[model samples]
Target: MKRIPQCDNTLGPLDFSKMHTVLVDVDVFNCGAGPIPQDGRDVWHNDFVKMPFSLSSYMKTGYTKQTNTVRWEVIYKQLRSLSKKTTASVKDLEDAIIKYNPKYKGQWSFDALSSLVKADPNGSNYSPKLFQKIAELALRLPELVKKAVPLLKRGHPAAITLSQTQIACLLANAFFCTYPHRNFSGPKAEYHNYPSINFTSLFGNASSRKKQKLRAIMHYFQEVTAKKLTGLVTFERRCLKETDLPNWRSSNKKMHKLHVASYGTIENEGKGMLQVDFASSWIGGGVLGSGLVQEEILFIINPELIVSRLFTEKLGDKECLIVTGSQQFSNYSGFGDTFEWKDPHEERLNRDEWARLQRQIVAIDALPFKHRSEQYNMNDVTRELNKAYCGFKGHQSNEPDIATGNWGCGAFNGDKQLKAVIQLMAAAQAKRGLAFFTFEDESLKQGLQQTYHLLVTERTTVDKLYSLLQNYCATQQAYGSAHVDLFELIRINFSPSKSLL
Candidate 1:
């Protein structure tokens, strides 16, 4: 066997401070040419205002009749003021709960459940345990909501509160995990690491204080405060930083979006401002499901006006203009014309573009592993590999290759490039402090690592493109001499090396 080339690792430290700040801003575009709504309120149609609140409240209740009654009556009245709107059916609610928890669907009646809800005006008769169970079961409502009005409605406080609170919980978990670990000393022994709740520890124990322990843990998280067992070390004060853009500073602004444009207007009492959007829908609040990917810890900053025209643009009530953010802001305000605005939805990448971008994403994924490797010069390999991957889509076919001439996109050598992309992803996850290798659920990471090694054995840096030719030649040479299939030589060679020696 030939010696494998050793990997190199070396790189300058990356500055992350610039990526730490983020801002969130939002504006609603008007569908009609009218004065913008004040106080950031978007007007929903009648269907939105009249969603079935009473039924939703009923769904929140468990077997208890009394508790469901009061809640039902309150929501029914609220629902009456607006035109009828469809809400999630009782069956849908049940399914949502089952999906959320993967348990508790078998314990209840769906038809009788509705009957109990209709019969009772209040859920007061239910015990705290029942109420708690209902709360747990109803946790999935937020995920099912299609519109924002019902989420913001006053009557459905439980769903609204749960939705908001769940979002908060998710954000809080992310924040907590971002911080460095701590040191602790206890009766059992000294320990070091982030303070984490051991769900198994609580679940496995059969002690009498189990309920009390659970409550205590919940209270700690709710309060965002640490409690000490021996009155010595605090557990909660150290949480994730509340910074807006911790990762953006290290990333390219060209790649990271500050805002996406969509159409709408901002109007006050008499005057209206119009904006043409090039980006799609945007929320001023921080984006969820970011930071889960490589080379970025995503968060929403205040939105920017990608394109806008003032109120007096003489645009027809139905027409809109889309502009780029680089355009001057003063161009938007005018006097008598009603104009509609829409962000550039057309700019969103098509399927082929997305696939190409996926290659870049994979490249970004490899960066963290590169930085963490024991090899120093290998760091350049990581960055250059990522840069090449990200740049591949924008490159003309005639451009020189970064790794090899055959390494261009969609070439036969693409399999090797794709393998590199996978390797980079594993490296990035490792850099994010995740346990990539040991985690069974991270199949992407595992598969990438396996494929890289396979390619390594099948080919080499020295052989590069001609490794296949070399292997085929060696096999054909044996066949030409013996006039037997290639397998016979391999079988004879494998039959006891010690006896042959």
Candidate 2:
């Protein structure tokens, strides 16, 4: 029988004209992500989809596939050990590798492992098994590591470089590919946003145009080889200053750094004015109740202690500032107002207890200001300041002689407001260093104890939120790119002084 070519209108060896256009649709259920056949359910006919392929496809296919089961198990075990706060050393890496496969324990010499990679005669070829694992694990490991270590300081040299190394290592290990060379200006390389690697150079040989394009794309974006790693070193170098990185325990008096952040009040009257008098009108006692006196209290009590804090090796150097700002206060009474002539109760707070409570209140005076002045120092400031006294402007003829509840009993209002402020201050202080007990008064002590826990809890929540936003933006590619929006996910870490204040 002779084979005949098909014609438009006649059925022969092949004919489409007589075939009916039937839209055979099948809803793909738990099958992995792949191109749908005309009939759809021929999924089993195709090779099983990759783990990530299946997971990503689930959003569209409504598939609940048990993909990544083995990979995740391995990754989770590695991460569980890696999550320790202690610095990861070469020993740790060696230990992990030894455990990964016992057969390689004695044979895995560092130089031997390094030399195992061969120059491909046909260009940089990668093992199929390695490439698949690298691409799959790359998407998941960072997320897990981020959870275990929430704060990654870019200023730390090791920290700044670690992200790039991790990305490169994961990809290389998975693909069994030679690590990309580091030559920033090479022809085949293009730098992206990463600031950790010194210079990444990706290479491609005589492959098909599409393959070359894929290689370029992978190196430029997916792989860590096409990013500027040394840019971070430049950034850190630019940030260094005289006040940063000093020996704290040094006996040299001239080099002794003062780290205080506060304002100077020359007037003796405001020295013991007490922060309780500064609560705003909403609290009725105004300035006295507002924890607005924090800065003043720190200065009056001991300025040097605060100054010593900011002048540390870890903190980048910044100029000291002298603040001259208004410190609001609420007026309780004057010469014409009634004054208490005697004690109201037989059981009175002892002098020591009263002093202790007063100290606690004073310690909290700087809380509000800390919220705003974190990046700079405010201590050297000589604030020619004034007090805003809040109360009723005029008196009515029908009004009772005694102050109304709306006006707020000055003493009670002052105490409550002071308590809230001190609580915040104590909590902030605790985060910076070991905190001291200042609440000696029974009443103030109770208030401090109750509010302290609340403030601490709130601080933790806010820190987490800020970190999430910061990390998101840092990890994600800049807007208008094909990369994941991982950078935008980070929350900004708040400076204890500025945001809270």
Model 1 lDDT tens row, 1-501: 000011111212211122111011112112222112122222233212212222332333457665544332432232222112233333443443333223344643344333333333243221223322323222322232223322111111111111222222222222111111111224342111112211222222233233222222233232222221110000000111224112311421111101111222211110111110111112111012111110111111101110010001112111112211111111112211221111111212111110110001111112222222111232333333333333222112222111111121111112222333322332232221111121122443344344344333332222221232234335544455333322232223323452357
Indicate the worst ten consecutive residues by lDDT in candidate 1: 229-238
- Among these predictions, the greatest lDDT belongs to 2
Most accurate candidate by TM-score: 1
TM-score of every model versus the real structure? 0.20, 0.16
lDDT of 2 by residue, 292-407 (tens): 23232222122111211111112112211111111111111111122111111121211111011111111101112322112112121101000100011101222111011101
Q: What is candidate 2's local distance difference test score?
A: 0.23
